[model samples]
Target: MVKPNRPQFTDVEGLAAMVGHGDAFGVGGHHFARLPVALLRAITRSGVKDLHYVSWAGGLPLELLLEVDAVAEIDLCFSSLDIFGLPPKFRAAAESGAIPVRDWTALAMIQALRAAQQNLSSMPFQLPQGSDMLARMPNAIAGPDPLAGTDTGFIPPLRLDTFVVHAQRADASGNVQIIGPRALDFAMAGAARKVLVTVEEIVPVGALRQDGRQSILTRNQVSAIALAPGGAYPASCLPFYVTDYQALSEAFAAKDTVLSDKLRLPSGGLSERLQEAAKVSAETVLAMPAPAQGDKKASVDEIIAARIAAELDNESFASAGAVSPLANVAYRLAKATHAPDMIIATMSCGHLDIAPSPMVLSLIESLDCETAAAHAGGDDTYSTYYQAGAVTHEIVGAAQVDRRGRVNTIALRKPSGGLLRLPGQGGMADVANMHRDYLLYIPRHSVQSLVDGVEIASSARGLLTPAERDPMGYRTGKALVFTDLCVFRLDQTSRELIVIETMPGVTHQQIRDATGFAVTFDAGCRELPMPSGDVLAALRNRVDPLGLRRLEFVSAKERGALIAEILAADRAMLERLIAAQKSPAAS
Candidate 1:
């Protein structure tokens, strides 16, 4: 795996000198700026280049973000907000008809590379078989050999010459560690002809091996490692350090943020922000604990049983009767079981007040990011773990469900019209495919949402038929349909939907009445526990005051009763504990 010794560049300027003017550069994840912003700006400003990116290029990494400093410019497609880290200016530029907008999915790119690595003629992508996107990139979809008959026209394979990445740490020999989902980062390493890595620390070859199989990134594919301390500063994580959530949010919010801004960023602006953010003190940040180490994994059977219990007891939390029981269950489960090395949670984009804490901070305080990311899943760094494969479990909100355990987040039938639609299908398709453990977080028993079978044709884009079942050996590894009243999981053998647990207030009949299909109920379903009074207070006072806020909306009676009942129940539990503690006879 020894790389041929090649000339090294000392700085961004030196690196730019080697790449020369007008050369095309492929960045690993266009989610945001990864390279020095200064170099990106310089390259784009010269106006002597063609920049091609494999990411959705219209948002955060917009061309104007680079052009502001006269750095560099790129002309490419994939201009929708669907691209993970695109800046607003980039989207506007595409809308302005300045740059071409190409529609493509990350999966398509990954599969293309997979096809290339395997030396296939071309890969058959599932979606967009007759898509408008295919019409634009005829060459991309058209295989080199027309006789091959493999292209499905949804998305074509992407071939790149070089890929640049920023890592938290890398050995001198090039093994790297990405603390979270370093999306497409690995694929890029394997797909590209050359890989350039900039890292915070350069460890000796033996240092990375000390961790054994725990190493998230292997260095053999790396062509170069630049000891750029703070090199990925404000852009990449250094493990224990804080993720600049505000900076990323602002970058997403800014009109002109772009990949060039990230690549050739001037140190001066970020330095000041870093200093200000650092005023919070390193100790505060470091206090966050990593996921409590040494906890064992919860077996699939164990998880099914727990969900049953949680569902049975869900009423305590749903009714605002005392969320402590629910919180305690989560806390205890987290404490007792080994958390995944990575976890992903789908959160709504709005509602900043409850946004999840930074990953580093979560590691310090809670040791997991689910609750935190649930609040901030819409933030720029959302879904980073999806590409990284660090997340073993992901909880997402679903709009509908079927008897077969399939869930849908978008596109349902409307009372007025035959179809009601959101913007379009999105990451759910990928998340459903990727998550080893998938939990659908939704309120129980929505009359309209639970479907007996697949409804609309929106996802006909990549529909896998029933006959095609288990073709890939991917059964939804773990699924828990969480609702206000009950929780359900797919049976291992049948994949038939099964109710594992019910809320304290909800009866089996109630659940049956709620679901559209005949649900197989656990005859001995358990009830969820009541949260501790203290945890209930924290949740009521801090986590959620309204109790019903997490729900889309609740009636006045619903809110008042749910809140008062939950608080009173917790108070009752607390008083009993206090009385027991005070009784000397008991002692």
Candidate 2:
């Protein structure tokens, strides 16, 4: 019943053969969703080396390649394990200079790919002037735009040799259907010389035409198609399975063993091993100790969230990106309380008109997908909103903050020539350049973080005064910082962050001691307003009933304890099963 002349229908091996050594590859998926894992496994089995990867946010597949020494270079906006924390293998490789890295912001990456798709030589963008990211980027040139007649940065086109993507379904004729928010997949595919798609299912021809909106690719654009159910294992495929958080936790806990023994398995055995590992992980999570009840005390994360929520104004459009659970909580709490009409846009949830259910550990899974007023068309939506100055507020965090409120979320080059590469700038650069107001949320305030100056300015208004900002297309947004101990506001005249208010228990000396540089206090500096009974009630009872905020403070020892308990339970279960089988009277 299958038609042979319908397009090239192939298997993983065939897909791998299409990829050659030293080819520049573009991968689809953001964080943990819809990754082309099966094809990546095949490529690993084929022992391809010296690959160059272009990804929006490099996740597990990219980390695996780094571990195997197969990747020569990486072009990415950000790279991490999401909620599970850092990707150890990738971090080690990047820090050791094992692989070359070219970092880009999420917006810049999309713009560059878009330029390639349109056959343009380059794309102009507005970013924070004097940012170290601009200086490091080889292709990014800084100058006044001839067309716009303003200061701007231009990124050259990035065209890949091959692009691999995963979809929910596809017809035999190679028409691909993608559900949920399509990240940079469409543009990446269009900009690539060849496109390969692995889908969960392959339907009959004309099956996808029923919903034309979901069909993002046609036969002309697709080079080949393969059926790869659960191809994005470990990562969520949406409407199919959520991310395997427990498995990732276990993997991170035992990174050496997992990466060496399990992830290095041959293609024929990798999927099976991953499935077995996932089963164990599921059991471990089900056996985790229940959180203590009857404790109504607010956690450090909750306090930070509540304070940030109070800063939101009604009827304003606010956005939060990845690794910002506290910011997302604050946005939801604001909607539930003071800002009932606030429009919140999260990178995972898109545009949410209504308040999402109580916070969960994972933003991608718990946020309301059905009720999202609109999907954030990935980086396109972000860039469009920013350029149009539609985003009023943005909540972001960074690895380091200088006296001038500048942020650095990139590498920390040591005097000994060692490197400590943090997750890249993501969309913070775009947010700094466009939004009317933005807040920096620092969970841990210390001398190291509140430094005199950053080695590299990733996002900030360095020397750009209000006059300069206007000419450069930068907004005159109030730059405020919220930390665990105090609140700091940037002085309009000095551009230096000065203490505006201290927390309930914090002292002036504490603030001074925590900051690396000499501290300055405003004349009106006083204690921050404590969270009212009403705000606490809404946050605990409605906004975060599950008490998931505790995860942010969960220590490594606690995680080890949980893992030990899981192993004990597994052993006991196995022993009981063996005893029952032995006692059943051998036949």
Candidate 3:
């Protein structure tokens, strides 16, 4: 698949030349998958400065860009390193107010892009009726809704000077082939004035015709194509390699804030790095062993996951945002066991209606995204599900949740009467009200987390009654709270969370002691119904072989060890899968 210089092929310097200083650049990919990292590196290496960096899911790519002070401002929904915690650069910049920022909700950010895509000055999004997003930003405008009578919010278009994205492969003719999740690349490509693509490999002109899904972006849409193998090196690029987690984790734990030399690739270094990534990805791992067979004593994490999975029936539709392995596992387990027809969308938009695959963070985008039926952007997902009120279930986490079902993911109150900044609400604010079922899970069920009241309600479920929701074309939903100790459901009449069921060993007294507000149990309360033997088997063997569900439950002190174990298990699994794929019978 060696590519000759046809019209689209360009060098790294040439690709970087297309971008200018102080440009509103739209970046593609969700979380840590298929990011045009090599292209970003090239831009920074070329000493481009004062960029208005834009991203739907701003994480590692944002960090890399910010490392060299390339970004003077940011427009993104959320930024975090997932399990490793908040991105250091983003946190520092945000805390110090060193850079201008436009923190957006998932809906608002996508709506802006959709506006640009449709050639509109502004696009109408669902009004955040119960969310404090408008109050926080003070920039969103209200649009007249003559049709439904419900207030509609309009987001100004986020026109991009340049858009950068990575794909699995592209031909010399600039026909890009993305094997797994397109995420927001197609939308970004439509919204940008110029599209710059970095491909893992360059095939012949007709080679991409083998699959229609690969040919979505035409040569006309692309401004230039660059030859960069292992472009999304640290991130997962399906059909080639998964995330190099060891390198990423090392970066996470590294004291140095600057980008690692491994990531800051020279022109010739990319090929060598790609080869090393391939060799390391499939190598046998021995640090962690599989859980023992057939004895079905469930851990607290397994019990919670099982209980959550049981809530979903065959008709259920579930969605979970990024960095949520527990919810991701539950959705997959439910679909694999009883709820085979249940639809699941995870990693925000990267994996939609995904098939049950091994729950390894390293290969999440690879395995899950590849098996998914469809991938969408923020706009596509919100329009179809959130705005339409079509999603039946969404498992959202909270930093602080009150007895009134209000959640705060924005900031925490410090004892000194200041705010301890937390990760901003990444559409949890919208989904809390919009989704048909508000499923809140808190791994830690302490008094601090299960608060009496939230200082600021970043997200709260508002449409509990038909009178309020029906008139607005919204879904009437109830909040169900899942914790390590007990399960609570919002008493619709009271609009207050009451303990409905206790975990296997948890007692009423313990629940009362842990809760911040006065505790009341439901009249029909019973113990949490444990999963069936078949369900447990599906979880252990098929869905979560690496025990990734425990990630949410582990402590900050214990997280390092748990991540190491999971990574080792992930490498081991990849080794076997790759070997199986290469087997004679598999071929």
Candidate 4:
């Protein structure tokens, strides 16, 4: 029934063949949405070795390839499983020095792809000067800008040999259409030598033209198209499905079976295996108990959120990036309480004037607000707004913060040659540099996190003095550090982190013992004002009634116990089914 004249129509094998060994492959998707998982699975099954990968927000595809030893090198902005937690295999590979990785912020990565697409050799960017990223990346160098007459950092173009993306629909002529934010897919497709697309459906030739705006890539840009429905699998494909978070969480919790048993099918195709996995996921979720409820008192996450919200002034325009659920809540709470006119931006290309109701775990799913406006253009447009000083405030988190308020979300390299890679600086570096002023939020406080000096400075005030920072386009430097135990601000003279206030019942000794360096305080250090009953009510009853904040603090041991309980329940059900089948009723 299909036409053979369509050059776009191809099998997964053909898709895999297009990407040769040692070629740079640009993968499309953000976190979990619209990933070309089926194609990646095919490549893994084909035993294709020594491929290099470039991604914006790396997740399942990257982790799977690492598991099977398919990747030789990777270039990424951030690599994490998002709400599902860290990717075990990717961490193991990076920490063990089995693969080489080059890190960039989300904006930098997107700009690099854009530069390649426009056929430029490199692109100038405003990055945090004197950050450790400058040292880690050889291609990223400071040079005199011909236009500005001042030195600025530049990132070299990342040319890809092949680019792969999954979409909602595509025509036989290879016109690809995406429903939600395209993220980096368009730029990546343009930057690559070959473009392969997998779509949920193959429609008539003119079907995609009906909505010209949604059609991101033309026939000339795309080389091959395959019908790979549910290509993203556990990840969501907007307009078709929400992310199967329950399934993905279970798969991540049961790490031992994810690669060998659930993902890789022995005989059937990738599509079939994915369907079976989905069924299993649904059943497992149904069998499990409901999430545990929290006590009547305010959770640590709510307290953190409220404190961050209290910092915002009226007319503030803020942006919160991925893995920042608490910050997202803070934005909403700010709008609802004090800053009624505050504008909040989400990574999913949405702008909300009104706070979202019953906050979801992921901001991408919080698209139902009455006054929300969608920015269909994606990250490029968002970055432009950030660069233009439209974003007045930003809430960013870090893996490490030094005495000078420098932040590091990259890796901690050990003398033993193993690297402990935290999720790389997503857009934190860019936000910290571009925004007028920003607050740094750290949920957990410890000696390792509040360090004497960060092992790697992913985002920082840098060595520039306050006088120099103004001319360099930095409006304010490291305004505040909000942590569980206390609030810190940088000292004006020494630029050292100084504790200004402590949470109720927290002692000076406790703060000192937790910090890696000697603690300093203001002359009038005071106890933080406790949240009023009304504020606590707003956070509990309105903001997050489901108590999703518990997910952030759930220990590994607790997760293991939950996983064990699920497995035990599943085994009991299977045994009961087997016993029923053996009974002699009909026979």
**Of candidates 4 and 2, the better by lDDT:** 2
lDDT of 4 at 398: 74
lDDT of 1 by residue, 492-580 (tens): 56656788777666788878777788878777678655444443333333322223232222333354344344344333433332333
What does the lDDT come to for candidate 1?
0.42
User: Clashing residue pairs, candidate 4?
Assistant: none
Score each candidate by Cα lDDT.
0.42, 0.70, 0.76, 0.69
Between 1 and 4, whose lDDT is larger? 4
Clashes of 3: 0
Query: After superposing candidate 3, which stretches have Cα over 4 Å from the reference?
Result: 1-8, 264-296, 475-477, 584-587
The TM-score between candidate 3 and the true structure equals 0.90
Candidate 1 C-alpha error for residue 412, in Å:
15
Per-prediction TM-score, please? 0.50, 0.86, 0.90, 0.84
Q: Give candidate 4 regions above 4 Å deviation.
A: 1-7, 209-215, 258-295, 348-355, 362-371, 376-379, 413-418, 463-474, 559-587
For model 1, the run of ten residues with the poorest summed lDDT: 314-323
Better of 3 and 4 by TM-score: 3
User: What TM-score would candidate 1 get against the native?
Assistant: 0.50
Summarize candidate 4's per-residue lDDT along 1-587 as a digit string, tens digits.
11133346788778987778888888886667778878888877777788897887677888877777879998887888875567788788777777888887666677678788888889887765547676666488878899877877788888888888888898867777886567778888878888888888889888876763354577778888889877776676655554555466666767456462354322433333233222222223223333333346665677777888888778687776767767777877777677877777665443334344445332235233223554344456555676665676777777789888889888886667677778888767766756666578676789878988887888875533558667755565446888888999877677788899888789999999998999998889888876767777766655654445544555656755544443443344333322333442311
lDDT of 2 by residue, 27-78 (tens): 8876777778777877777888899988877778787677667899988878
